[model samples]
Target chain A: MRQRLMEATVDCLVELGWSGTTTTLVSRRAGVSRGAQLHHFPSKQALVVAAVEHLSDRRRDEMRRSAAHLPEEGRTRGVLEILAAQFVSPVFFAALELWVAARTDAELREAVAPLERRIGRETHAYAVELLGIDESQGDNRQLVQATLDLVRGLGLAASLSDDARRRSAVLDSWAAVLDHELEMP
Target chain B: MRQRLMEATVDCLVELGWSGTTTTLVSRRAGVSRGAQLHHFPSKQALVVAAVEHLSDRRRDEMRRSAAHLPEEGRTRGVLEILAAQFVSPVFFAALELWVAARTDAELREAVAPLERRIGRETHAYAVELLGIDESQGDNRQLVQATLDLVRGLGLAASLSDDARRRSAVLDSWAAVLDHELEMP
Candidate 1:
C-alpha cells in the first residue's frame, strides 16, 4: 500500500505537476483510502518527498541493472546513453517538479536538500565507478562531474521537447570527448 | 508600468514559484493599481506569459551587452562563464518555474513552447558567435549544444544549493575540453 501510494504520488507529480498534485488525487490514483494515505503521509510535502526518495532508490537500482549489461565495445557511449536516459525518465520529471516547488517552499526545501545531496553523492560515485576513471588523477573528478551536468542539461532540454536526435548527437560528441580526456595519461 | 509589472511578475515567480505567484501579488509588488494590471493582462496566464517574454528579451539584451566585453585571451572560458551565469540568474529561475508548470498545464505549455524554442535557438547562436566556432566542421554544432546543456545543468545544480565551487571546477574542466575538441581538425 505504501509503495502504491508513493508510485501514485510520482505519477500525479508527472501528470499534474506540483501545483495540481493533491492528496485526494494521489489517493484516488493509488486506490488507497484517504484515511490510510493520511496515516502514512500526514502532509503533501511528506508524501511527495517520500515519493522522490523511493523513486530515486528505484532509479538507482534500474541504473545498476542496466550498467551490468553495457556493451564491452563502446562502453563509454553506452554508459552515457544510460545516464542520459535517466534524466528524461518520468522519475526525473517528478523529482524536477518537487525541486522547483521546493525552491520557494522553505519546509519542503528543508526536507529535500539532504535527500538531494545524498542522491548527488551516490550518482557521482556511481558515474565514477561506471567510467572506470581514477578520480585521484588530474581533472578526472571534474570531468566526470561535467559529464553528469551535461547529461542532466540534455535531460532538461528533453523535458521541454523531443530533442532526441540532437541529444544523441550531443552524447556521441561528449562520449568521444570523454574517451579522449580520460584516456590521457 | 507594463515593464514594472512584468519585472514584478518575474520576481513573484522566482520568490513564490508559479502557484504562489498571483496577479494581486504582482500588482502589489509593482505598485500598480489592480485596474492597470488587468488592463495590461486580463488573466494570470497572460500576465506570466508576457512577463517571461519580456524578461527573456531583457536577458538577451543583457547577454549582448556582456558579450561585447569578452577578453580576447581565454575568451572561450569567459564566454562559458557568462553563459553559466545566465543560467543561474533569476530570469532562468523564472523561466524554469514556467517550464515545470507548463509540463502539466496544456494551456501554459502552448504558450511557453514556442518561446522556449526561440530562446534556445538564439542562445545557441550567441554561443556559437562568442566561441567563433565554425559549425560547418564535424561535431562542432553538437559540441556547442553540449556546452549549453552543461552550463544549464550546472545552473540547475546551483539552484538546489550553492554548488559554486564544484560548478567552477566543472566549468574549468569543460573549458579545457572545449578548447581541445574545437581545436581539433
Candidate 2:
C-alpha cells in the first residue's frame, strides 16, 4: 500500500508538476482512501518527502546495478551511454520535478537534500571506480565532474527539443568530451 | 520611452516570472501609465515577446563587448567564462523565465522560438571563434551546440540552488568538457 502510494505520487508529479500534485489527487490516483494516505503521510509535505526518497533510492539502485554489469575492462563511453540513457528517461524527469519543487518548499528540500549529497558523492566515487580516476587529486576529477554535468545538461536540453539532429548533436558532443578526456596526458 | 519600458519589462521578469509579468505590473514598475504601455505593446504577449528580444539583444551585445576586451592571446576559457558570467546573471534569469514560461504557452513559444534559434546559432559560432576550433564541417558544430545547451541547463540549475559549490561544480564540469574538446587530435 505504501509502495502503491509512492508510485501514484510520482505519476501525479509527472503529469501535474509540483503545483498540481495534491493529497486528494494522489489518493484518488492510488485508489486508496484519503484516510490511508493521511495515515502514512500526515501532510502533503510528508507524502512528497517520502516520494522523493523513494525515487532517489530507486535511481541510485539502478545506477549501482548498471555499474555492477560494467565490463572488467570497462569502456568509458559505453558506461556513459548507459548512464546518459537512464538520466534522459522519464524516471529521471520525475526526480527532476521533485528536485525543482524542493527549491521552494522546505519540506521537500529537507527530504531531498541528503539524497542529493549522496548522489554527488556516489557519482564521484563511481567515476573513481569506473574510470580508474582519482576524484580528489588532480585536474582529472574536474574533467570527470564536467563530463557528468555536460551529460546532465544535455539530457535536460534534449528533453525540450523536437529536433533529432539537435539530440544527436548533444550525444556527439558528449562523445567528443569523453574522447578528449581520455587523451589527456 | 520605449527603451525605458523594455528595461522595466526585463526588471519585472527578473523579479516576477511570466505569471507575474503582467502589463499592469510592468506599467507600475516602469512608472508609466497603462495606456502608455498598451499603446506601445497592445497586449501582454506582444510586450513579453518584445521584452525577450530586448533582453537577448542586450545579452548578445554584452557578450561581444566582453569578448572584445580579451587580450589577443586570450584562451577559449577566458572567452567562455565571460560568456558564462553574462548569461548566468539576473538579466539572463529574465530570459530563462521566458523559456520556462514558453513550455506551457504556445503564444510564448511562438514569440520565443526564433530568438532561441538565433541565440543557439550565435553561441555556437562564438564558441568556434573563441576556442579557435574549425566548426564549418564534421561533428564539431554539433558539439558546440551541445556545449551551449549544457551552459543553459547549468545556468538554470544554478538559479534554483543557493549552493555556490554546486554552481562552481557545474562550471568546473563545463571547463573539463572544454578541456577535453581542445585536446582532441
Among the numbered candidates, top lDDT falls to 1
lDDT of 1 by residue, B1-185 (tens): 99999999999999989999999999999999999899879999999989988898888899889999999888888989989999999999999898888888888889889999988899999999889878889789989999999988987877778778888888888888888899544
Q: lDDT tens digits, residues A1-185, model 2?
A: 88889989888766655556799999998999998789889988778768866766676677778777777543665667665665666555666666655644566677777776676677666765766655565556766666666566666555445564666556655655665555333
Model 1's C-alpha root-mean-square deviation from the true structure amounts to 1.5
State the lDDT of candidate 1 residue by residue for A1-185, as single tens digits.
Answer: 99999999999999989988999999999999999999989999999999999999999998999999999789999999888888999999999998888899888899999998998899889998898878888889999899899988888888878778899989999989888899544
lDDT of 1 at B135: 87
Would you give the TM-score of chain B in model 2?
Answer: 0.85
Worst 10 residues of 2 chain A by lDDT: A176-185
DockQ of each: 0.87, 0.42
Quality class of the docking in candidate 1, CAPRI style? high
Clashing pairs in 1: none
